[model samples]
Target chain A: MHESASTQTNPSPRVQRAPQQPKTADAYVVTPAIDVYEGAEELRVFVDLPGVAADGLDLDLDKEVLTLTANRAARGRDRAVTYKRRFALPREVAAENVSAKLEDGVLLLTLPKRAALRPRSIKVTSG
Target chain B: MWSLLHNDTMKLFDAFERQFQDSLAVRRADTAISFLDNGDELVISADVPGMKQSEIEIMIEGEFVTLRAERKPGAFEGFKLSRAERGAQKLVRQIELPCRIDAEAVRAELKDGVLTVHLPKAEGAKPRRIPVKASA
Candidate 1:
Protein backbone atom coordinates (compact mmCIF):
# COMPACT_ATOMS: atom_id res chain seq x y z
CA MET A 1 0.00 0.00 0.00
CA HIS A 2 1.70 3.19 -1.22
CA GLU A 3 -0.64 5.44 0.71
CA SER A 4 -4.02 5.19 2.49
CA ALA A 5 -6.94 5.38 0.01
CA SER A 6 -8.84 7.60 2.41
CA THR A 7 -6.13 10.29 2.16
CA GLN A 8 -6.43 10.32 -1.65
CA THR A 9 -9.90 11.84 -1.47
CA ASN A 10 -9.68 15.61 -1.04
CA PRO A 11 -12.64 17.33 0.65
CA SER A 12 -12.05 20.67 -1.04
CA PRO A 13 -11.75 19.23 -4.55
CA ARG A 14 -14.76 16.88 -4.24
CA VAL A 15 -17.85 17.78 -6.26
CA GLN A 16 -21.10 18.11 -4.29
CA ARG A 17 -24.61 17.55 -5.55
CA ALA A 18 -26.88 20.59 -5.69
CA PRO A 19 -29.72 20.82 -3.21
CA GLN A 20 -33.18 20.01 -4.59
CA GLN A 21 -35.48 22.97 -5.04
CA PRO A 22 -38.96 23.14 -3.54
CA LYS A 23 -42.02 23.63 -5.71
CA THR A 24 -43.39 27.20 -5.65
CA ALA A 25 -46.17 27.11 -8.24
CA ASP A 26 -49.91 26.62 -7.93
CA ALA A 27 -49.77 23.94 -10.62
CA TYR A 28 -47.69 21.70 -8.38
CA VAL A 29 -50.47 21.39 -5.79
CA VAL A 30 -52.69 18.31 -6.10
CA THR A 31 -55.88 20.02 -7.23
CA PRO A 32 -58.27 17.12 -6.72
CA ALA A 33 -61.14 16.47 -9.08
CA ILE A 34 -63.97 16.43 -6.57
CA ASP A 35 -67.67 15.63 -6.29
CA VAL A 36 -70.06 16.33 -3.40
CA TYR A 37 -73.38 14.69 -2.68
CA GLU A 38 -75.95 14.93 0.11
CA GLY A 39 -77.37 11.72 1.50
CA ALA A 40 -79.99 10.88 4.11
CA GLU A 41 -77.65 11.49 7.04
CA GLU A 42 -74.25 12.53 5.64
CA LEU A 43 -72.34 14.17 2.84
CA ARG A 44 -70.18 12.09 0.51
CA VAL A 45 -67.04 13.24 -1.30
CA PHE A 46 -65.13 11.71 -4.20
CA VAL A 47 -61.67 12.90 -5.21
CA ASP A 48 -59.90 11.88 -8.39
CA LEU A 49 -56.15 11.39 -8.21
CA PRO A 50 -54.40 9.75 -11.14
CA GLY A 51 -51.22 7.67 -10.82
CA VAL A 52 -51.29 7.56 -7.00
CA ALA A 53 -51.35 4.22 -5.18
CA ALA A 54 -52.78 3.01 -1.88
CA ASP A 55 -49.38 2.66 -0.23
CA GLY A 56 -48.37 6.14 -1.37
CA LEU A 57 -51.52 7.89 -0.15
CA ASP A 58 -51.82 9.62 3.21
CA LEU A 59 -54.99 10.89 4.85
CA ASP A 60 -54.89 12.82 8.11
CA LEU A 61 -57.61 14.48 10.15
CA ASP A 62 -56.61 16.93 12.84
CA LYS A 63 -59.36 18.79 14.68
CA GLU A 64 -61.39 20.22 11.80
CA VAL A 65 -58.69 19.90 9.20
CA LEU A 66 -58.80 17.14 6.57
CA THR A 67 -55.64 16.58 4.60
CA LEU A 68 -55.03 14.27 1.65
CA THR A 69 -51.56 13.54 0.33
CA ALA A 70 -50.47 11.23 -2.49
CA ASN A 71 -47.22 10.27 -4.20
CA ARG A 72 -46.75 8.57 -7.58
CA ALA A 73 -43.82 6.73 -9.04
CA ALA A 74 -41.93 8.15 -12.00
CA ARG A 75 -43.38 7.03 -15.35
CA GLY A 76 -42.08 6.91 -18.87
CA ARG A 77 -39.18 9.35 -19.04
CA ASP A 78 -40.87 11.93 -16.86
CA ARG A 79 -39.95 12.92 -13.33
CA ALA A 80 -41.99 12.03 -10.24
CA VAL A 81 -44.82 14.37 -9.23
CA THR A 82 -46.47 14.76 -5.82
CA TYR A 83 -50.02 15.94 -5.16
CA LYS A 84 -51.57 17.27 -1.95
CA ARG A 85 -54.94 18.78 -1.06
CA ARG A 86 -56.45 20.11 2.19
CA PHE A 87 -60.08 20.76 2.98
CA ALA A 88 -61.49 22.61 5.97
CA LEU A 89 -64.12 20.52 7.64
CA PRO A 90 -67.46 22.29 7.78
CA ARG A 91 -68.12 20.82 11.22
CA GLU A 92 -66.69 18.09 13.38
CA VAL A 93 -66.38 14.80 11.50
CA ALA A 94 -66.19 11.24 12.84
CA ALA A 95 -62.44 10.79 12.60
CA GLU A 96 -62.54 7.23 13.87
CA ASN A 97 -64.84 5.86 11.15
CA VAL A 98 -63.48 7.77 8.17
CA SER A 99 -62.71 5.45 5.28
CA ALA A 100 -60.92 5.85 1.92
CA LYS A 101 -60.41 3.81 -1.24
CA LEU A 102 -58.34 4.22 -4.36
CA GLU A 103 -59.41 2.56 -7.61
CA ASP A 104 -58.41 3.07 -11.19
CA GLY A 105 -57.05 6.60 -10.69
CA VAL A 106 -59.59 8.05 -8.31
CA LEU A 107 -59.33 8.57 -4.53
CA LEU A 108 -62.53 8.23 -2.57
CA LEU A 109 -62.71 9.71 0.91
CA THR A 110 -65.90 8.98 2.89
CA LEU A 111 -66.58 11.41 5.71
CA PRO A 112 -69.57 10.59 7.88
CA LYS A 113 -71.35 13.66 9.19
CA ARG A 114 -71.15 14.13 12.93
CA ALA A 115 -74.28 13.10 14.82
CA ALA A 116 -74.98 16.66 15.88
CA LEU A 117 -74.63 17.97 12.35
CA ARG A 118 -77.24 15.57 10.98
CA PRO A 119 -80.87 16.58 10.92
CA ARG A 120 -83.11 14.94 13.50
CA SER A 121 -86.77 14.04 13.07
CA ILE A 122 -89.10 15.25 15.83
CA LYS A 123 -92.21 13.28 16.80
CA VAL A 124 -95.22 15.51 17.33
CA THR A 125 -97.94 14.38 19.72
CA SER A 126 -101.58 15.10 18.76
CA GLY A 127 -103.01 17.53 21.28
CA MET B 1 -50.37 57.84 -45.42
CA TRP B 2 -50.79 54.26 -46.78
CA SER B 3 -48.04 52.92 -44.47
CA LEU B 4 -49.82 54.45 -41.49
CA LEU B 5 -53.07 52.61 -42.36
CA HIS B 6 -51.20 49.28 -42.71
CA ASN B 7 -49.54 49.71 -39.27
CA ASP B 8 -52.90 50.49 -37.67
CA THR B 9 -54.50 47.40 -39.18
CA MET B 10 -51.60 45.24 -37.93
CA LYS B 11 -52.00 46.61 -34.42
CA LEU B 12 -55.74 45.84 -34.45
CA PHE B 13 -55.09 42.24 -35.51
CA ASP B 14 -52.50 41.85 -32.77
CA ALA B 15 -54.94 43.05 -30.17
CA PHE B 16 -57.59 40.61 -31.38
CA GLU B 17 -55.10 37.71 -31.22
CA ARG B 18 -54.02 38.60 -27.71
CA GLN B 19 -57.62 38.81 -26.51
CA PHE B 20 -58.40 35.39 -28.00
CA GLN B 21 -55.41 33.79 -26.27
CA ASP B 22 -56.33 35.35 -22.91
CA SER B 23 -59.87 34.04 -23.12
CA LEU B 24 -58.61 30.55 -23.92
CA ALA B 25 -56.37 30.59 -20.87
CA VAL B 26 -59.23 31.75 -18.68
CA ARG B 27 -61.38 28.83 -19.84
CA ARG B 28 -58.62 26.39 -18.96
CA ALA B 29 -58.41 27.78 -15.41
CA ASP B 30 -62.13 27.38 -14.74
CA THR B 31 -61.93 23.65 -14.05
CA ALA B 32 -63.12 22.80 -10.49
CA ILE B 33 -62.93 19.45 -8.64
CA SER B 34 -64.49 18.06 -5.46
CA PHE B 35 -64.26 14.82 -3.43
CA LEU B 36 -67.01 13.39 -1.24
CA ASP B 37 -66.87 10.28 0.86
CA ASN B 38 -69.58 8.43 2.71
CA GLY B 39 -68.78 5.38 4.85
CA ASP B 40 -70.15 3.11 2.14
CA GLU B 41 -69.02 4.78 -1.07
CA LEU B 42 -66.87 7.57 -2.44
CA VAL B 43 -68.26 10.13 -4.87
CA ILE B 44 -66.20 12.37 -7.11
CA SER B 45 -67.83 15.47 -8.55
CA ALA B 46 -66.46 17.93 -11.09
CA ASP B 47 -67.83 21.13 -12.56
CA VAL B 48 -68.13 20.78 -16.28
CA PRO B 49 -70.91 23.30 -16.22
CA GLY B 50 -71.42 23.71 -19.95
CA MET B 51 -70.58 20.23 -21.12
CA LYS B 52 -73.11 17.80 -22.55
CA GLN B 53 -73.21 14.19 -21.43
CA SER B 54 -72.28 12.93 -24.87
CA GLU B 55 -69.24 15.15 -25.08
CA ILE B 56 -67.73 14.02 -21.81
CA GLU B 57 -65.43 11.02 -21.67
CA ILE B 58 -64.08 9.35 -18.51
CA MET B 59 -61.36 6.74 -18.71
CA ILE B 60 -59.44 4.91 -16.03
CA GLU B 61 -56.12 3.13 -16.44
CA GLY B 62 -54.24 1.52 -13.59
CA GLU B 63 -54.48 4.16 -10.86
CA PHE B 64 -55.05 7.14 -13.13
CA VAL B 65 -58.38 8.57 -14.28
CA THR B 66 -58.79 11.02 -17.12
CA LEU B 67 -61.80 13.27 -17.72
CA ARG B 68 -62.14 14.97 -21.09
CA ALA B 69 -65.01 17.10 -22.34
CA GLU B 70 -65.40 19.39 -25.29
CA ARG B 71 -68.06 22.02 -25.84
CA LYS B 72 -68.79 22.27 -29.51
CA PRO B 73 -68.37 25.78 -30.87
CA GLY B 74 -71.98 26.02 -32.05
CA ALA B 75 -73.67 24.02 -29.34
CA PHE B 76 -75.77 26.97 -28.35
CA GLU B 77 -76.92 27.71 -31.84
CA GLY B 78 -79.10 30.78 -32.46
CA PHE B 79 -78.99 31.75 -28.79
CA LYS B 80 -77.59 35.20 -28.22
CA LEU B 81 -74.61 34.99 -25.81
CA SER B 82 -75.73 37.97 -23.75
CA ARG B 83 -73.80 38.42 -20.51
CA ALA B 84 -72.84 34.73 -20.71
CA GLU B 85 -69.95 34.01 -18.36
CA ARG B 86 -70.19 30.18 -18.39
CA GLY B 87 -70.21 27.43 -21.05
CA ALA B 88 -68.34 27.51 -24.36
CA GLN B 89 -65.31 26.11 -22.60
CA LYS B 90 -63.64 22.70 -22.91
CA LEU B 91 -62.69 20.90 -19.72
CA VAL B 92 -60.14 18.14 -19.06
CA ARG B 93 -58.98 16.78 -15.70
CA GLN B 94 -56.80 13.81 -14.73
CA ILE B 95 -56.71 12.45 -11.17
CA GLU B 96 -54.60 9.82 -9.36
CA LEU B 97 -55.77 7.41 -6.68
CA PRO B 98 -54.39 6.72 -3.20
CA CYS B 99 -55.47 3.07 -2.86
CA ARG B 100 -56.55 0.11 -4.92
CA ILE B 101 -60.26 0.27 -5.69
CA ASP B 102 -62.87 -2.05 -7.19
CA ALA B 103 -62.88 -0.92 -10.78
CA GLU B 104 -65.75 -3.23 -11.65
CA ALA B 105 -68.09 -1.40 -9.29
CA VAL B 106 -67.24 2.09 -10.49
CA ARG B 107 -70.22 4.02 -11.85
CA ALA B 108 -70.68 7.55 -13.15
CA GLU B 109 -73.67 9.81 -13.59
CA LEU B 110 -74.21 13.38 -14.74
CA LYS B 111 -77.06 15.63 -13.70
CA ASP B 112 -77.58 19.34 -13.18
CA GLY B 113 -74.22 20.17 -14.75
CA VAL B 114 -72.29 18.14 -12.21
CA LEU B 115 -70.57 14.81 -12.89
CA THR B 116 -70.65 12.30 -10.04
CA VAL B 117 -68.58 9.15 -9.98
CA HIS B 118 -69.09 6.38 -7.46
CA LEU B 119 -66.05 4.34 -6.45
CA PRO B 120 -66.54 1.41 -4.13
CA LYS B 121 -63.72 -0.19 -2.20
CA ALA B 122 -62.52 -3.64 -3.22
CA GLU B 123 -63.40 -6.62 -1.04
CA GLY B 124 -59.81 -7.30 -0.15
CA ALA B 125 -59.10 -3.63 0.50
CA LYS B 126 -61.92 -3.09 2.99
CA PRO B 127 -61.28 -3.41 6.70
CA ARG B 128 -62.10 -6.80 8.22
CA ARG B 129 -61.58 -8.68 11.43
CA ILE B 130 -60.55 -12.23 12.21
CA PRO B 131 -62.49 -13.70 15.12
CA VAL B 132 -60.72 -15.91 17.63
CA LYS B 133 -62.33 -19.22 18.77
CA ALA B 134 -62.03 -21.12 22.06
CA SER B 135 -59.78 -24.17 22.00
CA ALA B 136 -60.77 -27.44 23.70
Candidate 2:
Protein backbone atom coordinates (compact mmCIF):
# COMPACT_ATOMS: atom_id res chain seq x y z
CA MET A 1 0.00 0.00 0.00
CA HIS A 2 1.17 3.48 -0.72
CA GLU A 3 1.68 5.89 2.10
CA SER A 4 -0.09 9.25 2.21
CA ALA A 5 1.22 11.96 -0.04
CA SER A 6 2.89 13.77 2.82
CA THR A 7 4.45 10.61 4.23
CA GLN A 8 5.48 9.36 0.84
CA THR A 9 8.00 12.13 0.45
CA ASN A 10 11.42 10.53 0.79
CA PRO A 11 13.01 11.65 4.07
CA SER A 12 16.31 9.86 4.40
CA PRO A 13 19.52 11.28 2.87
CA ARG A 14 23.17 10.71 3.62
CA VAL A 15 26.57 10.13 2.06
CA GLN A 16 29.35 7.61 2.82
CA ARG A 17 28.90 5.80 6.10
CA ALA A 18 30.60 3.27 8.36
CA PRO A 19 31.09 -0.12 6.75
CA GLN A 20 29.44 -1.98 9.57
CA GLN A 21 26.10 -0.25 9.01
CA PRO A 22 23.48 -2.11 6.96
CA LYS A 23 25.24 -5.29 8.09
CA THR A 24 23.31 -7.56 5.77
CA ALA A 25 24.68 -5.87 2.63
CA ASP A 26 25.69 -2.54 1.16
CA ALA A 27 25.19 0.59 3.22
CA TYR A 28 21.99 2.55 2.62
CA VAL A 29 22.44 5.38 0.13
CA VAL A 30 20.58 8.65 0.31
CA THR A 31 20.73 11.15 -2.53
CA PRO A 32 20.82 14.67 -1.20
CA ALA A 33 19.43 17.51 -3.27
CA ILE A 34 21.97 19.97 -4.60
CA ASP A 35 22.23 23.37 -6.27
CA VAL A 36 25.13 24.18 -8.62
CA TYR A 37 26.00 27.75 -9.39
CA GLU A 38 28.28 28.97 -12.20
CA GLY A 39 30.14 31.98 -10.91
CA ALA A 40 32.65 34.18 -12.70
CA GLU A 41 35.64 32.85 -10.75
CA GLU A 42 34.33 29.63 -9.32
CA LEU A 43 31.61 27.04 -9.72
CA ARG A 44 29.85 26.61 -6.39
CA VAL A 45 27.81 23.59 -5.37
CA PHE A 46 25.57 23.57 -2.34
CA VAL A 47 24.33 20.26 -1.01
CA ASP A 48 21.89 19.59 1.79
CA LEU A 49 23.30 16.71 3.81
CA PRO A 50 21.82 16.85 7.23
CA GLY A 51 23.13 14.62 10.00
CA VAL A 52 26.60 14.37 8.49
CA ALA A 53 29.51 15.65 10.53
CA ALA A 54 32.90 16.96 9.42
CA ASP A 55 34.70 13.69 10.01
CA GLY A 56 32.03 11.69 8.23
CA LEU A 57 32.45 13.63 4.98
CA ASP A 58 34.62 12.37 2.07
CA LEU A 59 35.22 14.28 -1.16
CA ASP A 60 37.32 13.39 -4.18
CA LEU A 61 37.99 14.87 -7.57
CA ASP A 62 39.42 12.57 -10.25
CA LYS A 63 39.95 13.77 -13.81
CA GLU A 64 36.71 15.75 -14.22
CA VAL A 65 34.42 13.70 -11.98
CA LEU A 66 33.77 14.87 -8.46
CA THR A 67 32.54 12.31 -5.95
CA LEU A 68 31.12 13.03 -2.52
CA THR A 69 30.34 10.62 0.30
CA ALA A 70 28.95 11.43 3.68
CA ASN A 71 28.16 9.31 6.71
CA ARG A 72 25.44 10.34 9.11
CA ALA A 73 25.60 8.85 12.59
CA ALA A 74 22.14 7.45 13.20
CA ARG A 75 22.65 7.70 16.94
CA GLY A 76 21.41 4.21 17.72
CA ARG A 77 18.63 4.51 15.18
CA ASP A 78 17.90 1.73 12.70
CA ARG A 79 19.87 3.08 9.77
CA ALA A 80 23.28 4.72 9.74
CA VAL A 81 23.21 6.32 6.33
CA THR A 82 25.97 6.85 3.82
CA TYR A 83 25.02 9.39 1.16
CA LYS A 84 26.89 9.33 -2.13
CA ARG A 85 26.75 11.37 -5.32
CA ARG A 86 28.96 12.16 -8.31
CA PHE A 87 29.03 15.23 -10.51
CA ALA A 88 30.64 15.48 -13.96
CA LEU A 89 32.17 18.92 -14.15
CA PRO A 90 31.68 20.82 -17.39
CA ARG A 91 34.95 22.77 -17.23
CA GLU A 92 38.43 22.18 -15.91
CA VAL A 93 39.08 23.10 -12.30
CA ALA A 94 42.06 24.89 -10.85
CA ALA A 95 43.81 22.13 -8.96
CA GLU A 96 45.09 24.22 -6.07
CA ASN A 97 42.18 26.62 -5.65
CA VAL A 98 39.27 24.22 -5.07
CA SER A 99 37.84 24.61 -1.58
CA ALA A 100 35.04 23.21 0.60
CA LYS A 101 33.11 24.31 3.68
CA LEU A 102 30.33 22.71 5.75
CA GLU A 103 28.06 24.25 8.32
CA ASP A 104 24.76 23.18 9.86
CA GLY A 105 24.75 20.02 7.78
CA VAL A 106 25.02 21.98 4.53
CA LEU A 107 28.09 21.32 2.39
CA LEU A 108 29.35 24.12 0.19
CA LEU A 109 31.92 23.33 -2.48
CA THR A 110 33.85 26.12 -4.19
CA LEU A 111 35.31 24.78 -7.41
CA PRO A 112 37.59 27.42 -8.89
CA LYS A 113 37.82 27.47 -12.66
CA ARG A 114 41.13 26.94 -14.43
CA ALA A 115 43.02 30.02 -15.64
CA ALA A 116 42.04 29.52 -19.26
CA LEU A 117 38.41 28.74 -18.50
CA ARG A 118 37.77 31.83 -16.37
CA PRO A 119 36.47 34.75 -18.43
CA ARG A 120 38.92 37.63 -18.61
CA SER A 121 38.68 40.98 -20.39
CA ILE A 122 41.52 41.51 -22.86
CA LYS A 123 42.62 45.14 -23.33
CA VAL A 124 42.99 46.42 -26.88
CA THR A 125 46.24 48.37 -27.31
CA SER A 126 46.50 50.51 -30.44
CA GLY A 127 50.02 50.51 -31.84
CA MET B 1 -4.29 -3.31 6.20
CA TRP B 2 -1.50 -1.02 7.28
CA SER B 3 -2.14 -1.42 10.95
CA LEU B 4 -2.63 -5.17 10.75
CA LEU B 5 0.60 -5.86 8.95
CA HIS B 6 2.64 -3.33 10.91
CA ASN B 7 1.51 -4.63 14.27
CA ASP B 8 1.58 -8.36 13.62
CA THR B 9 4.28 -8.98 11.02
CA MET B 10 6.89 -6.42 11.92
CA LYS B 11 9.77 -8.91 11.76
CA LEU B 12 8.78 -10.13 8.34
CA PHE B 13 8.48 -6.57 7.09
CA ASP B 14 11.91 -5.72 8.38
CA ALA B 15 13.34 -8.79 6.69
CA PHE B 16 11.92 -7.63 3.39
CA GLU B 17 13.63 -4.29 3.77
CA ARG B 18 16.96 -5.94 4.55
CA GLN B 19 16.72 -8.17 1.53
CA PHE B 20 16.15 -5.29 -0.86
CA GLN B 21 19.10 -3.15 0.27
CA ASP B 22 21.71 -4.86 -1.88
CA SER B 23 19.75 -4.67 -5.10
CA LEU B 24 18.17 -1.24 -4.92
CA ALA B 25 18.99 2.37 -4.13
CA VAL B 26 16.87 3.70 -1.29
CA ARG B 27 16.08 7.39 -1.21
CA ARG B 28 15.73 8.84 2.26
CA ALA B 29 14.30 12.27 2.78
CA ASP B 30 14.42 14.50 5.83
CA THR B 31 10.93 13.54 7.02
CA ALA B 32 11.91 10.12 8.30
CA ILE B 33 11.77 9.69 12.05
CA SER B 34 12.00 7.30 14.95
CA PHE B 35 9.69 7.27 17.98
CA LEU B 36 10.84 5.59 21.17
CA ASP B 37 9.51 5.11 24.63
CA ASN B 38 12.04 4.44 27.39
CA GLY B 39 9.37 4.35 30.12
CA ASP B 40 10.50 7.70 31.45
CA GLU B 41 10.24 9.70 28.27
CA LEU B 42 9.16 9.62 24.65
CA VAL B 43 12.01 10.40 22.30
CA ILE B 44 11.66 11.44 18.68
CA SER B 45 14.48 11.77 16.20
CA ALA B 46 14.45 12.85 12.57
CA ASP B 47 16.73 13.79 9.70
CA VAL B 48 16.36 17.31 8.25
CA PRO B 49 19.44 17.95 6.17
CA GLY B 50 20.57 21.47 5.21
CA MET B 51 18.23 23.19 7.62
CA LYS B 52 19.52 25.50 10.32
CA GLN B 53 18.04 25.30 13.80
CA SER B 54 16.61 28.77 13.46
CA GLU B 55 14.28 27.63 10.71
CA ILE B 56 12.57 24.93 12.74
CA GLU B 57 9.53 25.13 14.98
CA ILE B 58 8.04 22.47 17.24
CA MET B 59 4.56 22.43 18.71
CA ILE B 60 2.98 20.07 21.16
CA GLU B 61 -0.72 20.06 21.93
CA GLY B 62 -2.14 17.37 24.19
CA GLU B 63 -1.12 14.09 22.56
CA PHE B 64 -0.07 15.61 19.28
CA VAL B 65 3.34 16.75 18.13
CA THR B 66 4.09 18.80 15.06
CA LEU B 67 7.30 19.81 13.36
CA ARG B 68 7.64 22.65 10.88
CA ALA B 69 10.62 24.04 9.01
CA GLU B 70 11.67 25.72 5.79
CA ARG B 71 14.90 25.31 3.81
CA LYS B 72 16.35 28.50 2.39
CA PRO B 73 17.44 28.60 -1.24
CA GLY B 74 21.19 28.77 -1.54
CA ALA B 75 21.39 29.97 -5.11
CA PHE B 76 21.85 33.61 -5.99
CA GLU B 77 21.08 35.95 -8.88
CA GLY B 78 22.75 35.07 -12.21
CA PHE B 79 23.53 31.56 -10.97
CA LYS B 80 22.27 28.71 -13.10
CA LEU B 81 21.07 25.58 -11.30
CA SER B 82 22.60 22.64 -13.07
CA ARG B 83 21.19 19.78 -10.99
CA ALA B 84 18.93 19.50 -7.99
CA GLU B 85 17.14 16.64 -6.25
CA ARG B 86 15.97 18.52 -3.17
CA GLY B 87 15.99 22.04 -4.58
CA ALA B 88 14.21 23.78 -1.73
CA GLN B 89 12.00 21.87 0.69
CA LYS B 90 9.53 22.69 3.41
CA LEU B 91 8.60 20.23 6.16
CA VAL B 92 5.37 19.90 8.12
CA ARG B 93 4.81 16.92 10.40
CA GLN B 94 2.02 16.06 12.80
CA ILE B 95 1.69 12.86 14.78
CA GLU B 96 0.02 11.52 17.86
CA LEU B 97 1.80 9.82 20.73
CA PRO B 98 0.26 6.97 22.67
CA CYS B 99 1.35 8.43 25.93
CA ARG B 100 0.94 11.94 27.23
CA ILE B 101 4.05 14.01 27.85
CA ASP B 102 4.97 16.81 30.20
CA ALA B 103 4.97 20.05 28.27
CA GLU B 104 7.42 21.72 30.61
CA ALA B 105 9.89 18.84 30.43
CA VAL B 106 10.34 18.83 26.69
CA ARG B 107 13.90 19.23 25.42
CA ALA B 108 15.31 19.29 21.93
CA GLU B 109 18.60 19.45 20.08
CA LEU B 110 19.50 20.00 16.44
CA LYS B 111 22.99 19.02 15.30
CA ASP B 112 24.57 17.92 12.06
CA GLY B 113 21.14 18.25 10.45
CA VAL B 114 19.49 15.83 12.88
CA LEU B 115 16.74 16.89 15.24
CA THR B 116 15.97 15.01 18.44
CA VAL B 117 13.12 15.82 20.77
CA HIS B 118 12.64 14.42 24.24
CA LEU B 119 9.28 14.60 25.95
CA PRO B 120 9.17 13.39 29.51
CA LYS B 121 6.34 11.03 30.30
CA ALA B 122 3.43 12.40 32.24
CA GLU B 123 3.63 11.58 35.95
CA GLY B 124 0.31 9.74 35.98
CA ALA B 125 1.11 7.69 32.89
CA LYS B 126 4.37 6.34 34.33
CA PRO B 127 4.31 2.82 35.63
CA ARG B 128 4.48 2.63 39.40
CA ARG B 129 6.78 0.33 41.30
CA ILE B 130 5.15 -2.32 43.44
CA PRO B 131 6.27 -2.81 47.05
CA VAL B 132 6.47 -6.38 48.23
CA LYS B 133 7.01 -7.38 51.88
CA ALA B 134 7.18 -10.72 53.74
CA SER B 135 3.74 -11.93 54.79
CA ALA B 136 3.14 -11.63 58.56
The DockQ score of candidate 1 comes to 0.01
Model 2 residue A105 distance off true place after TM-score fit, in angstroms: 1.1
> Highest DockQ among the candidates is held by which one?
2
Kindly list the per-residue Cα lDDT of model 1 for residues A1-127, writing each as its tens digit: 2235654675643233212223323224444445544343443555555556678677878775566766655432334545565655444356666778776455656667577755567799998
Cα lDDT tens digits for candidate 2, B35-88: 888788888887787777789999999889999988866657755554455667
- How big is the positional error of residue A107 in model 2, measured in Å on the Cα after superposition? 1.0
For model 2 chain B, the run of ten residues with the poorest summed lDDT: B5-14
Worst 10 residues of 1 chain B by lDDT: B75-84
Which candidate comes out best when scored by lDDT? 2
